[model samples]
Target chain A: MTGPGQMLRRPLNPYLAALVSAVVLIGTLALAIEQRAAILRDGREILLKTEPVDPRDLMRGDYVRLGYTDLSSIDETLVTGPWPDRDTTIPVWLTLAPGEDGAFVARSASFSRPETVAAEEVVLKSLPVRVTVAQPSGGLNAIGRLEFGIERYYVPEGEGLEIEKAQNQGRTTVAVRISPDGAPQIARLMIDGETLYEEPLY
Target chain B: MLRRYLSRELDQWTRSGLLAPGQAQVLLADHDRRYTGFSLSAVLAVLAAVLFGAAVIALIAANWEVIPRATRVIALLILLMAGLAAAAVAVRRGAPWVAEAALVFTLLCYGAGIALVAQMYHLSGDETGFMLTWAVGALVVSFAFASAMAAAGAGLLGFGYLLAVQDLFSGSGTNPQDLSSYATVLALAFAVGVAAWRSRSAIAGHLSALLLISWVMWVIFETTELEPGYVLAALGAVAFGAGSFTPSPLTGTISRHGAVSAYGAVMLLSGLGLIQVSLVDPGLGVEMALAAFILVVSVAVLAVAGGENRLVRRFAYFAFACETLYVVGETLGSLLGSFGFLFLGGVALAVMAFAVTKIEKRFKKGEARP
Candidate 1:
């Protein structure tokens, strides 16, 4: 420990250490960049959001206040069973017909697959959106690691900083996609999403 | 023709005598049995583990409350013990899956307890008990198993606890009375955490840092009540001290988080202190001494910022910048302040040049550290 400063770094290597360090640093940087990119890409989810639910999480603070994409104008009658409430993050199958808005209105939702639908049932991804610590109060709107049939929750930093803040502050707003069957899947958080700070009433 | 052809082939094979099928067939069968048996079982074992994992999650969610609090705690401890046993068995028997399963369950249970508390208490301001429990439990598990994840979790839990209890530390009135006491507690916490860190236990550093930082901030916030000026004086010294210890991430980070507030307060207090000194208030000598001490700290900070650590240098540079800004703003605000601006500007520019030159020197030195 030449200067007491060297004491900290004595455990690491010397000559090839920089190369190893660079790899480690770059790998971490890439992940961070990827996380930020994910939030930036899906920024539009802010506009599509509809429902708000509170989830008690430690990393992201006390609750997961969230909203979902609004399908208010979609058909309500074709729906089947209850949606995932505060209970589960289960898959909710749905079939939607093209509405006047050009968006597929959800025709039905169920735990089991629908046998037939007048309109083609487009299989949509139901993801559990979470407020990552890195981008607390924001979302990395990227095409997640999993494209469909999976939810993506990002870890903001090596240790969750922003998420902890939000959890402590109760400012992290997460959005979930609720199928007509009442089953809910996490969509995205309101952290970086273009939405107001408040929880959506619906 | 068929008889002749068969006879010729039979004669050739009999002559070769190397066309025996039974030995090769038996060897192939034995190999198949060896490879297929283990591979199939491995696949099945993984599938079974996944199913069990799913069931564990389901059970926790379904009967979250049916399992008593005490039972969950005991189960977590048992699971941790089981995980260690499994790891040991795996190491001994060469069965990696067994150990992996045990570890996963222990980790999950350790994490789940905190989540359960948050759920049980509705996780509002009133959920302090839950936070404390999670933090403590996580700390125990982390140290017991030397698990980094658990330690980090504990650290986060500790931070959450401080935030939840900020009211107690925030203090009331204008005097920051509890600083010395709070600092002592933080120091003790840091000592314990360091021991844990040295042991390579999870969450030790995190927990230690979380406590230390929150305590420092709380102390600053609390102490500001007595005389907001002391915070700047103390924090500025540390920031400068940080600059002195360049290329250290710990020091760098500490300076940023701790000294940022200190620097802000320094500028405000220094300007105000200068004005008070000029006025010659009866007890102004004490204030003047404090101001001089602060100036020494700033000079030290400049020297430290001369180091290679980006965080340290940035903070030191920011401190200097803030100091200059404070002098300029304060002088402009006061009638005589304008007259001293020229002198201050010269000193500030000189400091900046010195810092720039040190940058090259610092980088060269940095290249040598391991």
Candidate 2:
């Protein structure tokens, strides 16, 4: 008995097969490069103070795990949107403003992107956080933990320890580029307010 | 291996007057001529491709700073194009095995390209996203070449995505309401199945089925209202019925190269075992009733498909023996001392073994009649 796949089988030209596969392969890589470059090209810059935890990834090699001080824990009173009933990850938009130490801190957060923003303040989108508990009045009892896409800074092999040491000394900061849509790209790494590694726009 | 075994057996049969003298040589030659597609060179080519791809991935993971990032990217692109060109040449020359190896190599290079791009930019995307992207690329390659190897790769990557997103290994419960996440996985699994069908690759088909089963297990892990044991048992019964009792043509198609009945029997027995585990300490009447039901199911499975399937027969014997010991231990262990329980358990297993041997003899006789 012939199956459906057997019925549909027809010989394709080898050159055409190769061409189609190559297009998919190259197109995926090109799209990834262009997306990252666009964010770095026309995005607002913000300096964030972070603490680093070291972990090794098999695919991306050794890296410094960055935890933002101001954005990691936001007060429940600052949240201005309805919270989900169940524990599930949802995207959050945070408005950042300069604090006393000249580093950006989250001033207000919302489930949806805010339309209006002050000139001095920048809105950055968090990846998602599992909201554990919610209040009856459309607020969260606990916002759980939040992360931006700029959480991990990949370093060369055996060089993560140097950044980890600097972070331990409270001297490490990250420069992030925020696109108009609240997406952020890591632009540079700094120690003691001095630029350590600047990202290329490739 | 089959050819050599046939040769030895034919020579003995000829000597014993079971066959004519020249028949062995003719049969051996025919077998050799009919099965010439598999070649050692093709296997070696695929192995070499895999080794080369792994080396490229390791180079990317090393974050090698000696060469500039853009230069490395360009080199990878060149290698990918070269692989595709090789595949085209092989296909044009009608060397299908070489074409398949080349396609596999190109897919691996594409995955390495994703990892390299992510590392170059320090993109903090989760592993699930990375695996999904790689899997999508593999699916495209599979469709383009109708390559079984690429389809199998996609199946594996889809399984990896499920593991990354769900707490399968960690045992941490995921939210049951996250059906949308599982929907994406189901779609990937379906694509893999279609790819396997297009390639007519039995290995890919098995992998696709296993992926779907893993997805079902993930769902079972998340939801608590339905008991997993019962669900597995019910599904297994349906699968077994479809494989063993379906009218011809469909039954022949499903069981042609794989034993669906064996897998079904396994799931059924596992479910029964879980039900036993959940018993904890039930009333004597309930315990006896559950034990009787398990024994009956084992015997029924043996009676249904045990003659034709060796795996099912073995599972039946195993379940029967285990249940005998459990009943003996539960009923007689307390009344008798530890030594007495061990003696009785040994005796019970010995009796079950004897019965199984008799059953095997009957099955052999039944087969011999045909």
Candidate 3:
């Protein structure tokens, strides 16, 4: 045992161990909470129409699985900039604008963040999606899938099916707040233009 | 088990006049004192903590609506703090086992708290991220308290993170383009190695070694079109060389557990077995050559470290027997049909049994001398 590990064999003072553990654990939790809270408080808000499915998570209870309209699968022609060389997941910048139903829809996308967009359009960052198929005509024809990290709306046990039903009927929409970095956080859940649950900044 | 065996052996030795009656009691007492850290009470305490932690996690998963989300968060935080406080108190009272159990409880609470918050805020993160965060928390605890249990926990969680990222279990090889994922796992494994060393946990040390081996295998499979069996064999040869030939001081810590030699033997045998299976229609020449190579390697391993290392010796004997049977089946079975194959197999095994008896005697003699 005579090695670097040997050098570290002396246990920390019990009180010191306790203090350090508290600070690290508490700080991590607080940071996670604050990051989401900041986005909820100060980021741009937009409502997007969604289709929901239901699934139960072992650790996180029942939840509605959401698929945003026109966001999960974007037209390849809308992609601007050079595509990745290999089939791998890469973040794409999506520019969103209000559609006829007042829910935001993706207008265009790019491999890199757009330098500018129309005054009414807001740019949102997409979770990394695998580029599955590329067209010879300088556009991505198909991607594995896109995610915004707002796909799942955790709900009380056994209640996810109701929201899933509403969403499948084209009646459910999600209000999401996009931080400056293009990360989107769920701000509220809505059904038929009425807020069902509003998130509180903790 | 060790204590029981030692107790029985001590009594037998005393009765046989190998030790005086009172000397046996002194020896038993010394053994008990030295191994108190790993007593049954400690194991039971840790098990109880694990059960309690699981209950807390289940409560969070139930998403109990009676308590508001914010209140639930506060309660979890309080629980985590209280667990840490208890660990400190246990340490102060000189109850190391209780302190370790408390630390394990707190780490579990931290993970459950993460799950609870993720659920409450509707955060859509993958399992890899969740496991990585939990592992990092466990690492912090390990370092803070110098707790071996916490280090082992971190190692397990790190393994979970690796599993979540790669479909390794599905037998679909890793995505070659995702080198970053493997690198991250390697880094985490290295961190676990350091933590294991710091905490002096043999279990964690073994885990870290296995993790590194797994990463190498993943990379080899991903990056190369060549036979993974051959690659693994070469790697194992190198490891075996290092483990057996590396001079003391350099190999002191690693060889203390004889892990390197054992893992090397495992890889070597597994690689050879893979080659044997992969050769679906190999000509007689190739099959015989592979069998000879396998037999040679097994013997070499046995001759090198088998005298001292029981694990390596067992693996060597297993590999030798399997390769012998395989060669017999492949060559003689094809020529003579089932009846002759059975006769030849029995004769070969009987001969092998005689040789193994001799080898075992030699090994015992070597042990006795040392």
Q: Give the DockQ of candidate 3.
A: 0.54
Q: Give candidate 1's error at residue A106 in angstroms.
A: 54
With candidate 3 superimposed using the best TM-score fit, by how many Å does residue B179's alpha carbon deviate from the native?
A: 5.3
Better of 1 and 3 by DockQ: 3
TM-score of every prediction relative to native: 0.35, 0.87, 0.90
Tens-place lDDT digits, model 1, residues B1-370: 4434644565566568855735544545565554332245555654564465456555544435456645654564455445445544553565544533443444455445444333322222233444555565544444343334445556666677666545432433222223433544564466437535633544466467547755765666654543444443445445444434434656535553243433433443354444444544545356545445545555554444434345444555555565565545454436546556766676777887796677657666776785
Question: What's the lDDT of the predicted structure labeled candidate 1?
Answer: 0.44
Error of 3 at B323 (Å): 2.7
Clashes in predicted model 2: 0
The candidate 2 chain B region of ten consecutive residues with least summed lDDT is B168-177
Of the two candidates 2 and 3, the one with more favorable TM-score, higher being better, is 3
lDDT values of the candidates?
Answer: 0.44, 0.82, 0.83
lDDT of 1 by residue, A1-202 (tens): 3576445323332223223322332343234334333433432221232232234443442233222233422233444664322222223345544455333445565544666655334434332211111234563322111112212233322334454454445444444443333233334444444432322211
lDDT of 1 at B339: 50
Task: Put down candidate 2 lDDT per residue, B43-147, tens digits, no spaces.
Answer: 998888898888889898888888888998999999899988998899888787898888888888998999988888887756777898999989888887888
Ranking by TM-score: 3, 2, 1
lDDT of 2 by residue, A1-202 (tens): 4675565555567788788988988999989988888888889999899865433422234777787877877787898867655556667799999998888999999878988899999999887566656545575467767777677788877887778778877789988999989988889999999999899998
How do the residues B38-110 of candidate 3 rate in per-residue lDDT, one tens digit apiece? 7789999999999989999999988788899899889999999999999999989988899999998999999
Ranking by DockQ: 3, 2, 1
